[model samples]
Target chain A: MFVHGLATNPGWDWPTFFQFFATRTIFSALWVTVQLTVYGTVLGFVLGAVLASMRLSSSPFLQVVAWGYIWAFRSIPLIVQLLFWFNIAYLYKELSIGVPFGPEFVHFSTNNLFGPLGAAVLGLALHQAAYAAEIIRGGIISVDAGQLEAAAALGIPRIRQFFRIVLPQAMRSILPNGANEVISLFKGTSIVSVMAIPELFYQVQVIYGRNSRVVPLLMVATVWYIVLTTLLSIVQYYVERRFARGTAR
Target chain B: MIDVKGVHKSFGDLEVLKGIDLDVPAGAVTVILGPSGSGKSTLLRSINHLEKVDRGLVRIDGELIGYKRRGNKLHELREREILRQRSQVGFVFQTFNLFGHLTVLQNVVEAPVSAQGRKRSEVEPYARELLERVGVGDKADVYPRQLSGGQQQRVAIARALALKPKVLLFDEPTSALDPELVGEVLDVIKELARDGATMVVVTHEIGFAREIADTVVFIDGGRIVESGPPREVLDNPVHERTRAFISKVL
Candidate 1:
């Protein structure tokens, strides 16, 4: 009972873990987590928007390419993809750009191309883009067919029709799901700990490994995740309310 | 003026408009009367290239609807060019397809400001005047869903008129309204007719057709059975199909 008590005791574990949390290094780790989530989700959204538009485009070749990308990324696990990207230096020694079947115009060694942090962001953003594309496509499709017809009949140009007529309405459908994606992506950033990227979760793992106190460090990470998700939910609520105007109650 | 010559359209194996020909003279109210699934709407939609015809031509004032005539081969115009042509042809849909997110005034001003690149300040006064003329002046800032079916249709008319289009196309404008709400919409159309607006209306409203149409065309099975002045075609039809249809509707 005495040994069990020492292992499980909150007072001992929490105080020791709190000392690590108070260190300036932990704050830097937290910043890394914030940066990864922000850059990852923003880049994901831009790529997702393009993929969704491509999937819905009239051109068959574009449709096939978008479909293939979404299928491949969505089918693979994010953790495996992260590891693959982290170890990509082995898969391809270098990346280069040039005219097709012509001399290389620019070259970058794979080892110099992406660090652990870059690999983590690339993995998460690519994975997030697959899901985001589907979400955005669903939102765009949810707008009534008649709305498109009405815009076409009114002689509004395709670009203006999308921006002024379609996208605003699509956003009404998109915001709720998009907010969920953002929150989920924030939590999913913890997966980067596998690559030793020194984000919040990675920092917690390091602290626990040093002190041999795992349970309390896990609790700290959980508390931070809950706080982040709650903040995201609040933002989602306000955005939804803004777009909900003019729609019937 | 609108001209549809040898227009043919099909969806899968089902032909919707079969070698159809129609001519709507300038400043004339040509009402197309038909039963459901008789291809009246298809013919109307082809005028502005909403639904591209498989064969033949749709020309507005001798200009091709959605194609550029380079010799004899009809090349489809780019989407941008098609959009520019569509602005001159106002279409009021059966369901009153107003931009639901927009206020009534926004719906009216969208085409002139966005499509024609007209200044909002210059377009706004005319937009307001059109709304007032159509009896929806006070409801400018209100969204579409808040308005009754009749009020919404009136706003749709005002929106169409905002473009000051070369021709107005109405595809069963009053059919989607409540029975009690139908008269307000027909009244707006009657007003447009009185002002010598060129229009092609597709409707089941027999009484309104008799009152407003200069020419009445009865269609069945994707073919125009009879067409003449409303009094002659509506009251004294020459074809058996027209007589049968007029009997059932009236």
Candidate 2:
């Protein structure tokens, strides 16, 4: 009886689901989600690498600063962080570029500088950076210290030692955890629905609310997420194989 | 042509190398033998400035190892300068610290091309020749993990030789090898010795030292007890500590 009810219920509007699935609205919303993830991941990891280096540096001040950043970001709820960024114009009415504690070179209203979408990307990248920093730092430390010692003894330049010897080894450790973060972020971009940004989840909500066919519309969003995440996993597999060069038996 | 004068090194509360003075004449083999924790390895590392000395200094061919002399005071060299100095001094570790991600030929070619700025075409031929010299020429394309521990050490030796260093320092190169695998690495070192390469080795292989070492130094309790020709230090009795240690290893 339950299976019959689920299959025959008027809420199971298969025609509407198929109609909306290929529509430009849903596709455009998905493109927004993809843009957020790409921007967030590329910018996040770049900032993360810098932060990881700072944490691993010999200077105590840099280490503490990186530690504090990771601690702060991890402690705050992601939704709350996103909300704060979205409403940043209320916190600071204007943003400026200038010498610190000196005359401002230029300024603009904060609302003009950051749309809801821009704020969402900024929030996601900054949040992702904190986790990426720790993941990268762990990967770096997991490599054998002797690898670096050997490089130094051979007089390979310090930068070359890190890029040629240490990074290739560290990537073998980093790829899995790093991919996990990226997939999490890809789905997590749906959270921007709170801002009414019309990404995949938010667009699905808009359609279901208008037509009052909630269940099938939600399935549309869910299936899209699974498909893209699977694609990301496939990409991760090939990347991992490349880094596993001499290590595998 | 390595000179270590009054070298002292301490790790926290324990003093590892205490007031070591030695001279490795150009084109000669100096073997340091000691029991575990006797600091023989520490002294060898000091020659290459791998372990910075607490006091005193090392000089290679009249140039300081990790410092520059400005008037009467000595200032530590910058990392780039120290790296340049280190390029001239090759070090081989006990665990065969070959670059595991690289093939044997790439391991041999890396330092010459990147560190010394030599052309790749020039370094590659020489690298292959070094691999052939070390008896692992056929294994050039394989990664270090694919080779046995003995083969890895030979590749490491070839990698070090690619730089054509003025001095080669080996810290227990054969200790990490299997009993049956030890002879191959020791044989390569012996061949290098025959070629008049300057080398300082720290090892427990008393037989190999007697056969290949021009000078054998016996160390105990972080100090060199006695040093002379292998026949004098190994066979004749001078210091009781040297005699006791030699008897046990023999």
Candidate 3:
């Protein structure tokens, strides 16, 4: 750490330039990266499952809607979507969290919700859901009709069968694909820097702009992302193994 | 406990089952033997509405099948009403369709717990007992993929029995098994017959029909050609088609 600072600026004391941020901004953004991934992944998975079911639904209207969504989102790159969502024009009205019939509980608008951190997470999540929908849809179809009949024969209702019998088998088909989505999501978070998310990429840009240490600061951001995605890959490996049980090795 | 009347079914231009009307008694084993494309399997599937019949009716325990909840012979019976009733008529396949994800114990207990709404804790012991009866008790914790062809078929039998069905249907149950594995499945069926369970079997196994069936039904070209006590039917057949089929297999 000391040598890196000195090498970047040798004329004066380097720690003065480094101490201001070493103790704060980069470290703070590290926390933001974690939060972005956690919140983004959760939101994305919930939305994606709904979208996938919509695509799988027998009704042509729903299938067409789902198809339209996937085509629009997946075709235009993730980086572009992240930027668009962060800007004012693209956002819908802010979220209003309230009881449906009773009373207005709370409302938060677009400006407030798209804070540096929120924008990053939201961008990654919405984009990720489209791909996840396709992954989940494929998994659901792979399950045989006979198995559903057997479940039906047991008098197990259709709704319960989706969660219980169908989902477990589908997990085997979906998890590997889902792992790719997660990794893609992690990469997608990089786009958040343009939204002023103050994530690793943003912090690196800030550091490089001030110090003219472009290569080193950019390298720092690159290392962090590599490490994080590598860790996610490890997690994915184990999840795939658990779901793939009893299938051919 | 089961009746079929004038059941006709077709697949596109190919007419599979042409006017199949057959009756099976309470607690009796009825074996259906026929050539390929003769529609024996189609006729059996039609009874449960698994394969829809263009025209005809199936009655199990006096309730008519293929009718709407309000439209037909039945005053009421939900789609699930039909499902629960159909659960009472278990169908075993040539390829054991035991759910690959679940353990043998879970497979055996799934219907009882989910369909019958029996407590899993209450049904667990019964499931184990059925597994043991089928000689797959040791494999109860194993998944279907982990078991042999014989073991999987037995687990399937155990799965069917988990429902404690009124009439068990076998669609060439042993036909998919290897030569060595076929005997184990047959032995399980023999035990089921002795226990007085009603069965409708589609099989090529002449000896099993002779040994265990109360009645042997020979269907040729979607029609019942000869049916009687197994010894009588297998020994001396009346129809040329039945005679020809028997001669070919022998």
Candidate number with greatest TM-score: 2
Instruction: Record all residue pairs in model 2 with backbone atoms less than 3 Å apart, i.e. clashing.
Output: none
Clashing pairs in 3: none
What are the per-residue Cα lDDT tens digits for candidate 3 across B1-250? 7899988888998878788778898988899999998999998887777777888778887877656545444343466766667677788887887788888888888888877888999889999999999998898887789999999999888888888788899999988889999999999999999989988999999988899988999988877888999887899998888888998987
lDDT per residue as tens, model 3, A57-125: 889999999899889878988778677776753457666778887677887787777665666676777
Model 2 ranges off by over 4 Å: A1-11
On a 0 to 1 TM-score scale, where does candidate 3 land against the true structure? 0.87
- Return the interface RMSD of model 3: 1.7
User: lDDT (0-100) at residue A140 of candidate 3?
Assistant: 90
**Alpha-carbon RMSD, candidate 2:** 1.6
Worst 10 residues of 2 chain A by lDDT: A6-15
- The TM-score measured for candidate 2 stands at 0.97
- The residue pairs found clashing in candidate 1 are none
Q: Model 2, B48: alpha-carbon shift in Å?
A: 1.8
Instruction: State candidate 1's DockQ.
Output: 0.80
Top lDDT hit: 2
Per-residue C-alpha lDDT of model 2 across residues A106-220, encoded as one tens digit per residue? 9999999989999999999999999999999999999899899889999999999999999899999889999999999999999999998989999999998998888889988
Q: Over the full model, what C-alpha lDDT does candidate 2 score relative to the true structure?
A: 0.92
